[model samples]
Target: QDEVVGLAGELRSYLSLSLPEHMVPAAFVVLDALPLTPNGKVDRRALPAPADEAYARGVEEAPVGEIETLLAGLWSDLLGVERIGRRDSFFTLGGHSLLAVRLISRIRQELGIELTLAKLFAQPVLFDMAGVIAELVEKSGRQLLPAIEPVDRGGVLPLSFAQQRLWFLGQLDGMSASYHIPLALNLRGPLHRAALIRSLDTLWERHEGLRSVFVAQGGEPHVELLAAETGFGLVEHDLRGVDQAQTRLTELCREASDAPFDFARGPLVRGQLIRLGDEEHVLTLTQHHIISDGWSIEVFLRELRTLYGAFLRDGEDPLPALQIQYPDYAVWQREWISGERQALQARYWSSELADAPALLALPTDRSRPAQQSFAGAHVDIWLDPELSRQLKVLSLRYGTTLFMTILAAWASLLSRLSGQEDIVIGTPVANRARTEVEGLIGFFVNTLALRVDLSESQDLETLLAQVRSKVVSGQDHQDLPFEQVVEIVQPARRLDHTPLFQVMFSWENEDVVAATKLDGLSVTPLETNYEVAKFDLDLALREAGDEIIGVLVYSSALFDEST
Candidate 1:
């Protein structure tokens, strides 16, 4: 995201060549790289895409009017750019939620506009933000106003294991690399070491999260600050002298897989430029899994391609200033999940699941095994298209998500297969509500115990309605932490019983739905390697670019894939 901003000055020239007219940015503000969690996802709330210096570059030619100059100055500081422009687009430059809050506060104080958070994200750049502010700024025509106030936003939920992993990984610390997607890049000429170094430098300067390293205060991983301008370097080598370059690449990759992300120096952050037998050049990015997630890899790939493309075009395409950061979102989350909010949400779950029990029961291969790590096979029997279509119709009629229809189907199947009335199943829930954190990626996801009871001879459609109603209630009460739910409800469990529910079922196929497409690239989908625990069955629906692949990793100790 930062790389997009650094190219702001030349945005109009490059992207305009191949993209639509509105695609270009009017101004750009470069900040430190993006922030990351322990598990290696971009901390959207930590985005420092301020607009305070939005007009620094264009200030020379800008109007001398007090309001206009004052506006430009604010843009400069907010954006962290040396100069600000009157025409800069907030989003085009990089402004996002964290900054939006400040912008709204400024509007209330300066122009008394009472701007909403929605309005700030909508109008991200200087001109648009000012225009919105101008409405109330001119109406009241108040005197000099204070710069926007920064909110203290963090510590939403004490870090979860997933979040901790991202934080540790972002600082270049933590776990070994579990996956690698090797791309052979054609640098377009004889291997030039300097050119490669320049490319790596471009990436380091542009991604704040990449530059960020972590430290542990009181035995917990915390954000350790860094100097943004302090750059990254690459050590070069000639593979032509070696018998085969690919062999060397594989070896280097192996080295990277074992290397942990270094919180002190940014582990797995370094790369080597090597020459193939004749003229080919290879640049490999090996970072630890703790700092980056699979999604983060995709984001990095797209941005790197754009950056490289820009360099090829001899023009920089910087985007607009951002509005906020991950920490800010974290702060917002704490406010949203407290007391009254929690109570309202809790009541929904309490009433919805009243006396409801499990939905899926399967005979165990081992009678309550002590412990197990199982990898089982899976086969999906897709309900006929006609049935799926009918399910959707029912969804619209009942006002529920498509998942409810499928979930009901699963309950029916389990009731018939197990010959039991009561069924128990687990469903992982994604707790993304606030608009700020939706696009800002993290493991803001959790698992919920969905107990669906298939009573004797109940109608299929009727059961589905019950399922839909409960889903709505669950969504409302999703704010209560899963741990808290366990504490409050205190669901009973046996020695080998899964904590809350068994035989998990989830339709995460919606995640792969299309959003935006890049200029020349197709998003290649890869099979996911997600680990599993001890269970009779577990299924996940992964929707890649254009395909939905059902992932079921079961306990081989419980049931064979052949079954």
Candidate 2:
């Protein structure tokens, strides 16, 4: 418990560097040990809640009017809580941007009043929120509202180490496909090879993370950035496989995606827009996650519709000049996470993992080997809509969100299957909250090391709260990239110690690249011929409006697809 005090202090110091005064955790609850799921990691849900009650104390005045009563109920319902006193903070109750979006829509549809996600964040509590709603309703004589508009956050930001790697890897795939589209393109309008080349050059010149490379300097890998000339060739080939042109493009993009995309690489990211067939094409755009995020990709895709539309209309000149390159954002990010800024992060990462040696014990088909090899398989479990609704309602009732509910359910599933007390899982965080980094389509994806303990039996209500806290706290410490922690902590990366987690579990809501139906091509995701990695198994959980599906990817060399 004393150690928890120290850890909290450290976190407070680190938080001071970047977070506002109001956002730091006000309480810290420590225990003899954190619990784990079958996969063996800290079980946040199991972390004992502070016995002392706090944050529940509310304003003296109660809901004032009919609208206020209605608004408070809406907040409580959307947030999945029994009660939401006017002063209670929405953020403290697991309200994220996605939730905010949903909240706004509900208020509009139910209340016949309008609200913006930004407004909710700015005035995060029910009291303030009620006032905002009251004013809106008063201003508009009729029960009407404006349509929600999308916001574009712009700026260059630093890439986490994993993001750096994914960037280069995406590029390697780009090189193999003439740095743009796919074979289907050649089968169709047959876009000019020269035109594609021109686009990559333009894109690479505009983004800095692109031309970066990794080199061994003085026996250590270092970033060696290249001043890529704003010129590259785009080669189109026949739908027939194995051509010199396709081979070369494939090699470059895939290799680049696999390599280190760092500061050395200026802000030039590349991808191909290959026309695979008559109207179908594969758009392989690879940028270091440094400049982009999942949300950014959505923006890029939408913008691309505009750019390609322009190009198709012979209006190639409409593209805007970038305000700043990725490097500029990178420099700013580094400053935001100075020494003091990282202290609390360091505490959280080290505390739960201190000298702890264990495995979450996922069911593996292969015998335990001396060396750690990344080879695995994938299994998808889709939850039907009715169950999905149950999960959603349960999250709210537990003062949590669907994300936490899913995690608890997944941890529960893993425990039932593997019978491990400590479970470790990997989840991805879509880091796109800031108003500055929205438009840049790059990778800002991160793999979160989630620890769940399924030791004692917990009812659904308690379990949801536990899972909720874990996720919220995890988000607080997300700035520390996974790779950086691996190097510093020296976790069991090998099978014997298995310092780091191998089984990954992700929950997302993104539509397939081309959700809408299109003609002339199947446009399916093809499994590439990549080797099993040192770390195997990634399970992605996703939801669309009301549907939930889980997709698992593993190493083919080690595990059977059916298993």
Candidate 3:
């Protein structure tokens, strides 16, 4: 046992040098001999599972003190791990933004102390979080309060700032399906179709955002929540015995995604279930961008899985009552983004983007089209592990984040490609700074036009510093709506290009590996080709484990594959 433990410890140390904390396995098991099948292939089912206490570093010290013990237990439960050490990092054990929200809520409930997601992000390890919790407990005694149920302000609500922008765009081009957000999942195993439908119905009932529609009232746009009794437009197609199941599934997905929603009469959200086989199915969900954002998708998926399981198990809704709804948030935003606060935000953004350029002037393969065509294609690039690691190290050294580092690199690339020193890139912020709106599913994303001037030909380190400073300042004033900023700056709007910035950049820090497991079913995300582009060139970078995966989305009308 001692020798095995020693070898495991050595292996862990070696892995630590190259692997990220999360990629390194929490536990390692050693087998003396392989269990093979008749074909001499290793029988995975016959392999012994690691012991509950087994960890990559061999024996781990148990959680010490009352706070540590409590936190360890909660972390273990949330992460679905049998044991968690004091030093174990929450994210390293597969905790993400959504799971973090749940963990923090549970902590608040149990400890009677309110904590923010930022707190968990700052202190991710079990030992550190416990220390923070202990300090809070010492300073302020436990004060538990019951959650207030959301009052259904039954009536038409004003469109949110983001929603208003989308509405205006839809008015300009109602037939365009560029604003659609489509997600498909491939499921294998036994799927109860009736229970799944029930869960989806429950979702539409609980969240009004899914059933919302925009109607003009007195020459102004207003939002109306459709009746809860309204059905979620779900259609199923069986291609069980089809010669080309994969081809048929692709056609179905494209048709669903390309279909436009009537914003005036929604069911803005729709679903399609394509049966590839008796046990294989493809589930596709399509929603307009006006009603949903990236964060809302995570909330939707998490809730769907929970509600489906509950329905299948006991035919009861296991989810808690929502504290607030999307309408409430819209009401609050209207009231909040006015008067002194609104003026302050306006002043900050106007000053920050005072002398920014109107366009990036990226070289194109073809002449600019008379009217913008949202057709686009994506090129993916994967950064080597060594480069990814160095980027992290550089970010730490410069007191910046991986996001800032990648943005800097992107700006540099654009500078090289365009031969322009001044670069402006649009990036989306989650805009869920308030705790009250965290759980609500709505369009809360706001785009910020980040302008960086590289005219001085500064070194990469200096440019990173500049980027970090601008990012911090921008985040501080992010509450100001992007539409308001555009109005303030009064950028020349052209049908051929997006105003303020044509190129955009986004970073996905969270692990969004879409995988769900229910009773006898395994769900995974399906890659779909929906050719629609919002900007001239939008770059999305995802930090997965130790590697950085980048996707450059460019307008196909302007650039070809070679470019």
Give candidate 1's whole-model lDDT.
0.52
Give candidates' CA RMSD values in order. 16.2, 15.6, 7.1
Better of 2 and 3 by lDDT: 3
Please tell me which predicted candidate would have the highest lDDT against the true structure: 3
Over 1-563, each residue of candidate 1 has an lDDT whose tens digit, in order, gives 55454354455445547853234544455656768978899765566554643322334345346655666666566667555666555544434333444444454555545555445544545666667767766676665532322254343223434446455434442243332223323343443344335555666655544554556667676543355566566656677767766676666645533455555556336665555545555555555433344444555555555655555546664433335434444445556567786777566556544565532457656555664344445665444444554664565444344566667777778778888776656676555444333333234555566666788666866787677655544543555666556545556655444555667777652332133122343322222223334456777654343234565666766666666
How does each model score on lDDT? 0.52, 0.56, 0.80
Worst 10 residues of 3 by lDDT: 52-61
Clashes of 3: 0
| Per-residue lDDT of 302 in model 2 | 53
Best by TM-score: 3
By lDDT, the better pick of 1 and 3 is 3
Give stretches of model 3 more than 4 Å off.
1-152, 243-245, 511-513
Worst 10 residues of 1 by lDDT: 523-532
What is the Å distance of residue 385 in model 3 from its true position? Answer: 0.9
TM-score of each: 0.54, 0.61, 0.76
Q: Point out the higher-scoring one by TM-score: 2 or 3.
A: 3
